[model samples]
Target: MLNHIIGRLSLGGLLARAVSAAALLGAFGGAASAVTVPILVADVDSGRVIYSQAPTDPWFPASITKLMTTYVALDLVRQGRASMDTLITISPNAAAEPPSKMGFKPGTQLTLGNALKIIMVKSANDVAFAIGESLGGSIDNFAAMMNDSARRIGMRDSRWTNANGLPDPQQWTSARDMAILARALIRDFPDDHDLFSISAIQFGGAVIPNHNGLLGRYPGTDGMKTGFICSGGFNVVATATRGGRRIVAIVMGQPSARERDVKTADLFDYGFAQDGGNGPGLDALPGSSSAAPPDMRPYVCGGKKVPAIDEGPGAVSASATTAAQLVGGAAASSPSLALAAFSSPGMRARTLPPRAPLQPVAVWIGRSPAEGQQILAQQAAEAQAAAANVRAARLEAAKARREAVLAKRQAVQAAAKEAAAQKQAAKAAAKASGGVPRSASAYTSSESASMPEAKPGKGLTKAKDAAKPAAHKPVAAKPVAKPVAAKPAPKPAKKAAAKSDE
Candidate 1:
């Protein structure tokens, strides 16, 4: 090894070898610190990037992938393939999705309009999956539609594997691509713009608030979505309108929801302050170095308990005061945000004020309000019938158990009675005899009538003889055996002749 190293050192100068070693180390060191936070803010009208940081780098889309799902559903509506009144039935496949889900049972039905509302505000994974299955006939088909639409709209770096933005290795998107999708959503479906801006939605008695922290807290922050996973961190594709100007901001790979929201607010502040476009339009951004996105599990979820769903409305952290000072005390002047700042001096955590009462838009199942009521009534009746059937089955099983017990008791009693009758007969027969009666085994007969009635004296004699002990015969046994051996065998002819005579 030393000789080989020496030869290489002689071929390439010692300085060159040292430089190569240093370069390799530096590359490894850079990778160790490569935890990037991709951010982008673009004008909605002019399609220009206002502020950006590694905007073209691929990153996990997380729940924000629902934005693409919403787009596809709305596009189908535009093409006259579906309508808002379209029914989406929850199948076993959809109902089985993980949390940030509605927990709807299989066979539950709801309108496309209600499903969209639930997915937008609550980011219900199950509902999103159902929409995919209902609208596209299956999850795979819907994903195909999503990819096709994305390509058509110039989202060059985005790839979708599922309707809901659940974690998947193959699924990824860049800030630039997400911005393009947001632009397309705003431009293509202007009439349905209110869908993205919903604050909260009322499904039944529970009111589910949107996961996007900026909606109600950040002034003029109207629509868009937020997403999170251990591998992706917190992501938001947020759009805010201030002073009659609207811009879309994409923030990705933040450690927490607070940082995501604060950085987004800061970007909006920066984007609105800019008078002209920054470098280039969103489409003109350069390609990424790698196609695969970086996994953020270590930075985002390291040594911490990560939440399964998007973050909900939370109290401002204690560091809000510290962050307020960093942003130049903009929090005191406006409830909207702090100020334009992006340095990671303190992670840029901000404290948002309490949100106002949410007027959640009402959402329900079925085609119409009246029809929904009828469906509810029908479900209630079916529940009652199922309960009744269960009760009846239990009662029948109990009755069978009782009947079985009674039959078992009757069988035991009949067996006992038969034994008693046999004992009584035996006792009566013994009582009739003065002495020990002859043993039943001594004279066995199939029919009593075949044997002649014994004379009274003879019967008593036989009984007495049977009860007496036998006297020991010394030489009688040998004599009787010899006599039997000497006897001649009977001929067949003689036996037949005797039988004929009889």
Candidate 2:
């Protein structure tokens, strides 16, 4: 690492010295301590740079890198390599990006247009990754495309290692590079000019506001973006138009979002007031070492802690719609509510102006319209299958409930039969203890047929005792006394006389 810097210093020493000289010359206007960031205010139409402060110094881009990512996608669309409706499925790598993200789960589907909206409005990291993977097949391959595109456009101070602009030492960009990219984005894609101007997006019933503050507060604010990270500080690439003139402002490495917005807004104000186009060309801006700048953690997250920032209305931001309008390069843009508020004395605006809302069209996985339809159909079929599975589960649950109910009823019935048998046994015991003839004659056949259960356990025991009739007959054979006929005694006496004669 030491050798690399030394070698660059040996080879690029003259350039560094020249940059220092230029920076010293420019430092007369703004105090060095007052503005730690690299700032630039340029006239977009005349190719004029109205302000410059370490514009070429290396700085981390943070979320603003999405601009280049968006640019690459627009180029693909122009070349017919992709379309705004191109479906970008969230891959695991894309879904794994840290917060300041949409948190879309893996395999989540969205069209390129919607993805771009999420990136611009939500400053979503995951969506940016999905966009990269969709266009370049992988984030690494897409980063290669970004570098190639940057070199082609002469963004010498910029390089991209990841799409979401998460912390990476190798991934850095400069104010000048970001300005060039912002201008190119505004220039090349006219139709998408509306994208940057979008103030907010309604997602899942919640409004995800744009990070660009200038959009609704500054009268001329139209479109552009803001970014931040502990290493990057608060950064923004903003544009605004007043009357026929338009300007782009890039502010990087401020201590807070409020300071970044107000300072940049004040710079645009200063630039628009300039009399003539007198500054170096965009490509001719002075730059120092190509290596990453010093870590800003101490300044941002260390001793003097940078406050948590949310870049929307009530946040420290200039008007972004006006910056977007600057992207449109539309000469006819009028001063909006942001301009009105800026014109008002001591008016600290709380929210952005309302947007002319439009729903984004769907993008699905497909090579063509027919293929996209096919994919949609497959998704529908899968959804239907899932519904069927749910229905089947509910049905099974109901069937189980019904079976339980029937089992309960059968148990109750069996219990009732056993209870009835017990009650009958108690009644038979009471009857057997009461008076009743033991002789079989007392129970006539007709009476026995009707009163088969007169004797306790007599009827049912017939079948039971058949197995051991002799044992049962002797156990309950209690003979009962009966009245005898008088003729029986006379007969007995006559029989006794006959027996004596014999």
Candidate 3:
């Protein structure tokens, strides 16, 4: 009964529902089922495949295409044709790429290291194009170099049509082929693999988080690429280390981000377990599954279509509407309509029509004084408003500061006046007491004067009281001397004395 239930559901069907449930619930806890999606897990140290399923089955690579771009770049560095610090200039073509891009304006410059970081973190399409243009002078020429490099590196079943993999039906790759490329990158540029391990990259006030979830979630997972497109689904080439063994796992056609990560986690768990003691050794795993027979079945969705991958200079013409405007307008109506349109063969063909010729607009130069005057007046009004705001702020600040300063000054002056009054009262009291005002010059000096020394029996009552015992011991009571009368005036006093004698 269990076998019947398991056999009733295809691996693809089970995965679709599992991915849906995981996305909604944020976890997966159902019965374990074998993952039938094409994958390749290999040991990076020995260039050995540990486990693989449909490793050679062809599938769209999406932005995983950037791995080849990096491979080509590193090859240039290895050949001494370029340095890792070289600066690449953004061109108009590069600036025109859709987002999930570093929206660097044309003529903007970034170092090779920064460009690679943008590619690894943001998966920036513009940076990829700029690198290609800088390296090969054009993306077309750069793609040729990429394919040649791939062939040289023994990626026998791989092809590249663009530097930043925007959807082209022709941009197909195999899991085994991607694993081979990943091995080359690690082996040839061990120094730069850290670029892939970066979790977040900041540029131009925009901080792009890496799409590869393994960087933070998986213990030993380090470097590689993740990719997605409507047709390609989600894919990743992930590297992890456990014990002394390093392995790379490639998963393609995952239904969603969570599924992709969970599936990758399972692969890592299995690979590590095998490394510990369970399964076959790395070398014993199948070397190369058969290459997918060429996709000879003609595309039947649209009227008999040419198989030529759209390789022209431009695939889509700039409409009267910008990409954002078109997408927004479509989304406002049906929400899911835009996505549905992209999936429809007819809409894709129409929307991505061949590039149109550049149309020139007539230029009218020279303005009348009145027109110029009007513009000047508008600018002057704006400037006046700004200046007025600045003046108002300055005035408010100055007023507050002035009030504070005034309060501080008033407090200081009141303190000074109080001190002066106290000093004046002290001087007046000393003068009233008939004491020779002790050291009047010292009192007037800014330095506070010490109290004068008290004389014996002088005005310091506290000292006098304290010295009462001493006061009694002092026996010098000098008699008060009255002024002597004049010899008396003369005769009157003499006559009085003669009478008394008779």
Candidate 4:
């Protein structure tokens, strides 16, 4: 039956050795005597517990707090209270947190979606703090909301003190409770579940590889988270799917990362075996071991350190004990120092009223100072020439504009005068022909005019005949004058020739 169960598990991926409870104890060696390492595996589809060893035992949550932070932020997006693209600014307090951070400067902004990616991939503590401050106004307020969400999700043994699980004894959760949270996260945020399965995330030039080993090694593994601290050792809540069967496993307090993977693989094998109807094979082992109790010594005593809570803007300083005295002391001391610091930067001398003018120092030279003044005169002359050129260019442009205007005016006057002369000549011709002058007639001349005594049809014919003769009359007159002048010129030349011959 055990072989059949192991075979069923091997159908999805190769089967590895199932380390017995005794082997688990030996692997822990002496460490198991002092710590309670709780391990739980469940069929996520049915929420049925397949195997359990101290499933309800509480342990430090470490950086696992980011999972809850992401859950709450995604909830806000789901509820329409915020959007994934909403920009979040890094506050001064967020910027001041230690690294394993996105390292955004105080005023740098990132979209809510990218910020969540940094928290999941980089485990960026500063981004978590900024998200808390942006969403709930403070980390404490955000943690309170986280606890509220835990209660809503039936995470009875979980409490969150900070967004990024940096250490707090007060901050703790059980394997069973973390499994419940993981289930809730997967069920509520199915779209973003792929973010957890990512093996590495690169932002800017920094590459943060996911700490969860199951993403790479486990064939069907898709999502969940990994966490660690000095006290918590290492913990992982892993989920895997095979042939439509999904399971969630929470392993806490594994001595080393290798043991954690081995134990998780064993849990998967056992889970696959049971679901495949393999008969129970490990009945000889005790149901519960008489292992030494968990060492709560680190958290129980006064050695547990309470983290400093950031006081937001306008918050009264935690060290301000006496309100009136503090206010009075600050008011009294601030102005004098401010004045002293202000006055020390040569400002006091600058602010003083002007002093009486000082007398000029005279120096004797071998030559008069006027000897050196020639270069200055030459520079002045060159400057004057440049100024004159600039003025000339301006004057030329102005002259061009004036000339264009005058030319346009002259064209208008010439057209008007030509129209007037044409009109007067048309009027005189109409009077001679005994016809009323018309506006159209102003454009006609005597050559276009017809005689009133002529027949209406033949009037144009007679006008053309009259115009032909008038055109030839100028040539006829030139010939007649030439003959008259020729006759007189021969008489004068003959008289002059006779006188010259005598």
Candidate 5:
């Protein structure tokens, strides 16, 4: 079921006249200035516009730029240049984008399919940038591809400068251009329609819901995208099917997400009420007079009271009184609904019900499911190894400190022992030299020979005399002289002594 109808929408001429600018301004909080937002509704099958309001006016695309990003990626898949499983690495440039991001670190990788799901559901800027880099080798290159595709697809009023649509003065698109692009995406990739309808995506422990409030809130609503910035307010490109007929609705520059959602629902009600009407194709829409897109910062973000941004967890639902207060007092609580308020003669602000429970689709990082597991396991193992190395280093440092302490202790003991030995040597030298003084350096020579040595019983004065030899008298020489003369007498005496001995 593919329809390549480019664009032709019947502008609700009577309907436009009935919904006066004053009425619209009252419904939009009765601000001082009445901002004219771009809106268009067209049948997907016949490519005929059911209702339109300044659809050709240029406006900031905001995050809806991801639709073009997605188309470019899907086109790559169609041309066989890449596949869904192609791995996209989050470079430093991607990781450094502003919030509404995935916070993936530089070098973190995920399959192109997972990345697409994240950007669609989470409106993640970082992931979108990474996808651009992966597909086109750089963001500038990817933007070139986007412009080339837009021109080729008959989108007359759109320019893309960045992948994530962060505030760039150069980037803008009109309701007509966005609708045509949406039609191309739907017609070109019938099998990939589910990509736009994802309710939420489960990434790791986090479950991020899609920002498009009408997905579950509105009955026939199926797939689409929503975007917001201070300068752009809120924008949405939504599609729905009813009674075997599908239609696309584009709303841009709403004051808040609540108005954006309510207006879209009202447009859907009007679109389904009509059969394909006669009108010019999307290409025939007149270009805007202004060269630059309107800056809605004053209306959207000025003053003390700022409107609810689109990045919140859920769509804002207000009671009738609260809604009246928001839109500068319109109506009281009643049984009437806000869905059909815009198309009716009088518009009233109403509250939306709380969103349905999220049905999360699982997304993981890597080239494949098995590869993701392997990468996780490898990371765990590396973390463990790093911890072990830290422990080892600590132990090594402690051991070195203990060794130094022990070496210091040993040195102290050795010094004490050497000191004791020296002291003993000094004492011995003092005793031998009669208590003569000496230093540690005097061990090489001793004065014991010149000094007196004290004995245990004798004093130091008698020690010299005790150490001297005894003197011999002069009788030693007389004994030798008398020996010769006494020899003759001794011989006679010896003879007598011998006779006596015999």
Candidate 6:
């Protein structure tokens, strides 16, 4: 089971882990992630912490959020507002949640008990959303209830913005807070406690297994929950009973889900070994309730944290409780299947979790099963009709898109044909006028060629001839008779004789 779960995490879900790691380190200097992951182990019988590390640091809760989500639903049942058989209808908003979902269509209806099993077994985000909507009228209203529950249970450092624990930087919890939540579930809702131990739920023709690997991989591990996100690596709050001694162990900010399990198992072993003093009460631990929630996104998802971040004393992280801006950055988004590969390849478990008896929680919508089914059938019909209308609308839209495309193509072809016709008309018109439409360059060249060539003598007259039309042909000159030269010579001799006689 661990192998199956971790295989999903390592495949592609951990991309954000590295990127978020880098940003967190840079923002908080170098030592932030080293101190933020909170771990707490407590003796359930005594409500005393056996061991703790960074118990008050705030971190993302991931799907461990379902614990509170389950608590709230069970609380409603105990309050007479709802029941184990309560039918939760999937709304559009709930259906829209990302994967790790049950993919139940809008208007789909099921008993609250069955929903709990599926979510606990499969960690379905959509079902969690639906559960919240069904309970407190809306997720927001349910969240208000969750906060109230957290306060009542002394989960001092936790805040919930969603039911499924998807990425919202604002959603945070601490290891101690989770332990508190786990203890509350154990103490308040003992009958419904088995929901967390379900190994798998059969949905349709397939089986969706629980995300918690410890259930079947560790000894004496009876029940609890596991969660992961990029910023908050692998987180698990596990509990096991051995020889009548029960210990609840929490491990957070693990690099992998497998590591989270191993650490948790070890903590439980350590917890059971203690016969000594039970530590302070969970809420009585030394820490400010107002401590800001630390963001581990950069370290976990940012792809930057190394195998080892140096451990050191707290730096400037200490700030006034009122002024602390603990918006833990880069909190885990939707983890892919690759986060915590179940086991390092070929690893065999020496001790697997003890099998828990199947105990289904029964919740109700204040109606008989048959009456509920009738109402559900009616709702299903309406939903189906609505879906048909939507499909028709979509088909109409597609037809419109295709028609628009075809019309655009036809317009382009028509424009091309009209341009060709206009060109032909222009050619016919030019030919009828007996005038060739020459371009400026062509006309200039023709005029230049028609101009007469100058005689090449040095004069302003020759310069003026340079501007003549290029097309002009020079006329051939006729040869002058030789008598012009003989007459000039004769006149010159007569003039010379007259000058001599004078």
Model 5 clash tally, residue pairs = 3
- On lDDT, the candidate that comes out on top is 1
Model 1 Cα lDDT, one tens digit per residue, 371-470: 8778777877998999999999999999999999999999999999999999999999888875544454344221243333344335434434444547
Better TM-score candidate (3, 4): 3
**Superior candidate under lDDT, 5 versus 6:** 5
Residue pairs clashing in model 3 are none
**lDDT tens digits by residue: candidate 5, 79-171:** 999999899999999999987888877898998999988888888999999999989999999999999999999998899998888899999
Give lDDT: candidate 3, residue 157: 68
Q: Pick out the ten consecutive residues of candidate 3 with the lowest summed lDDT.
A: 20-29
What are the per-residue Cα lDDT tens digits for candidate 6 across 1-502? 3233332222212233433211221223455422434667788877787766577877788888999999989988999999887888899999999867767778778888888887777778898999999888888999999999999878878899899988788888887888888888999998887787776675433555566767755667777877777767777888899998888888777656545665465455555656625478786887644456555565555655432211111111111111011112111221111111122231213223443433333322224556655765776799899999999999999999999999999999999999999999999988897564434112122123333322223223433444466678977878874543212224443343333322
Per-candidate TM-scores read 0.67, 0.59, 0.51, 0.50, 0.65, 0.59
Query: Quick one: best TM-score, which candidate?
Result: 1
Error of 6 at 237 (Å): 1.2
Scored by lDDT, model 4 comes in at: 0.59
TM-score of 6: 0.59
lDDT score for candidate 6 against the true structure: 0.64
- The deviation in Å at residue 196 for candidate 5 is 0.3
TM-score of 3: 0.51
Misplaced by over 4 Å in model 4 are: 1-34, 276-502
**Per-residue lDDT of 5-73 in model 3, one digit per residue for the tens?**
221111223222333211111111265322234667777766666556566656678788999999999
**C-alpha RMSD by candidate, in order:** 13.8, 16.0, 26.0, 32.1, 16.9, 15.9
- How should the candidates be ordered by TM-score, best one leading? 1, 5, 6, 2, 3, 4
The residue-by-residue lDDT of candidate 4 on 1-502, one tens digit each, is: 3222222211111112333321222122344443335767677766777656566656777677788998999999999998887777789999988756766667766678777776766677888899998998898999999999999988766778888877677888777777778888889988989777766665433355666655555557787777655566556788888888888888766433444554464455456545522222122212333222343334222254422221001111112122123223331323222112211213111211121222222211112234324534554688899899999999999999999999999999999999999999999988897564354232223222232233424444544554453555555344333322212223443344333322
Q: Residue 42 lDDT in model 3?
A: 73
CA deviation > 4 Å runs, candidate 3: 1-36, 276-502
Assess the local accuracy of residue 123 in candidate 2 as a C-alpha lDDT between 0 and 100.
85
